[model samples]
Target: MAISSTLRSMGLIGRCFVHPIFDYLVIGGGLSLIVIPAVYLLADPPVMRDFTMLPWFILCSNSAHFAASTVRLYTKPGSRDALPFLTMVFPTVTLGVLTLCMFEADVIGRYVQLIYLSWSPYHYAAQAYGLAVMYCVRSGCELTQNQKRFLWWIAILPFFKVLLVATSKHVVAWHIPEQLVWSQVDWRGGVNLVTEVLGVLAMALPLVLFAQVWLTNRRSMPLISLLVIMTNGVWFVVFPLIDGFVWTTIFHGIQYLAIVMIFHVRDRVARPENKRGVVFHTICFYGMCLVLGYALFNCLPYGYQMLGFGAAESVLLVIAAINIHHFIVDGYIWKLGRGDANRRVVETVAIGTGA
Candidate 1:
């Protein structure tokens, strides 16, 4: 509900490190201004890249980050209030049934997979939009009702366009079956034309929005707000689908983790029952995610295979189900508006100082 700096008596060096926007990006988003352009231009070096997926650390870590953040929502008290049964039952049923279908019914499996891919960018953009507005309000960039409405429209359009692009081009051969295609009228000419134009607009909108925000708020508008919104451009507009899966997703997870953990730590500290220290709580939080991630990623496949499910289909189904659950949970948990209790989770303050 209120924005305050996180800086304390650690002086100028401390100020640089302690600021909310800086900490948010560095710790949560896993990026800074310096890292973005370098990443855009850089490729994986010739040497072995990092961990499981090779050529990148992101591949191994992203799923855990996402699962961990979703688990954070469950642990947060707000989720229990906002229609607890739908939050608990819907995703569990979806995952269970879909996993069965993946093994038994190929047509349904493909459909579910397509839906997940189609919905992913919007889910991603939503997080960026929420964070952007939070930063905007924190910095006191007040806008008229219409202006705020337009801001959301701007945040949404790029991902929406990217969805169209996906539909036009269709999924790659390896990711899905030929039956899963979106029947493009003309693969090269008309479809490419539409996709290219959409791609250009998706890339351009964030920059346009950046200019508009600056014109509207001048120096008072936090640069971090603009940067958070533009992160969507990097994710949806710039990279190819597979590479974007690794690069953009990890950053998104980092951004989500940083903010959610802040909420968790704050809430934990506030509760009388929470006797554990921050370090212990942090480990417990992330450790749960890692365990869940392994189960979702590895255990699902093996368990399904043992149960006579198709290995590839089972993996895809489990991944989609968890992601769909995440999207649903996040929609409830981070519904930022006036008088929302979730607002309590993200309130900013001077680090080491009370509100």
Candidate 2:
């Protein structure tokens, strides 16, 4: 009886809220809420700060994304199977392992600040991997020697970025003990330059690929892909300019807005017709607004900190809400305006016949 009831409850939840949008939002928001607070709570007031929770949160987030990619691989019918598996699934596993190593007490002692420094390159590698898989899957024409050489060079870019980051640590080695010194304008200039260059490359690569796809296919790619690109781009640009973990806090606090927008766009486009059953759209929308809003407003920037919690949270909340609404509405137009699946099938067939 208990099992039956639990199943029924889950059924209802799925019916009411289990769309891609809701899935990502809830997963992202939940992980952020737990991870952000946990990081702050665990950090020692005086000395070595415990960042175990951040890694754990990243693990959870990446795991959720991997699960989503798996679902897409199996359920999407015509989607490229190998690309998503190799790119998304494998990276998630790598990230999970990295996170585990960072958080494990034994491993943490050896690594110290190494994990934090490694995160930027690790993500760049993962993104490069994904882009490479995408390039292979979408390589319609036979590749010439020049194209192959270009591809190889592109593949090596992430490693170069990693090397730059590794070397930048030496820039302020003498001032390592002093937070003020490290944070000083002159000392951090080199670090900023290295980080920004990596950030730009990471952000630009996807946009170039997306532009290529748009020119060739003219069909709308998945919103998740777009979101990933946009988020990374924004992170690369905004975070470096702002220059600190505070940006991370702010980025995370309001990232739910982007998740919500993506969901709203996805639902509008996908427009799953099985309306009789329960639908779980907008879980990320409503849930994130509540949870993230609370965190931003109540918990973040707390006390006599540099940025006041209430002020920062309020501003971010407004921005997030507006962006979410705009994305949902825009997505509706983009997807619904293109018509349903049957229409698209007819259009494709018509194009083929015309050709």
Best prediction by TM-score = 1
- Per-residue error for 225 in candidate 2, Å, reads 1.3
**Clash pairs detected, candidate 2:** 15-278, 15-279, 16-279, 16-280, 17-279, 17-280, 18-280
Query: How would you encode candidate 2's per-residue C-alpha lDDT over 1-355 as one tens digit per residue?
Result: 5754443233221211235454334422333345444654886432213555654443233223323322323333233432455434653554354334333434342232433344433343334333333222222222345444443444445445444444433234323534565455465577668767866765566566545544444332333343433343443344332232333334443443333344343444465563431134344333434554444333432421333324433343333322222222222222212443222422332232211
lDDT of each: 0.62, 0.38
**CA error at residue 280 for candidate 1, angstroms:** 2.5
lDDT of 2: 0.38
Tens digits of per-residue lDDT, candidate 1, 12-46, equal 12111136555556543537345655755685522
Which segments of candidate 2 are over 4 A away from where they belong?
1-20, 23-116, 119-198, 217-220, 240-355
Where does candidate 1 stray beyond 4 Å?
Answer: 1-24, 27-60, 168-219, 337-341, 348-355
TM-score of each: 0.77, 0.32
Pairs clashing within candidate 1? 6-351, 28-254, 28-255
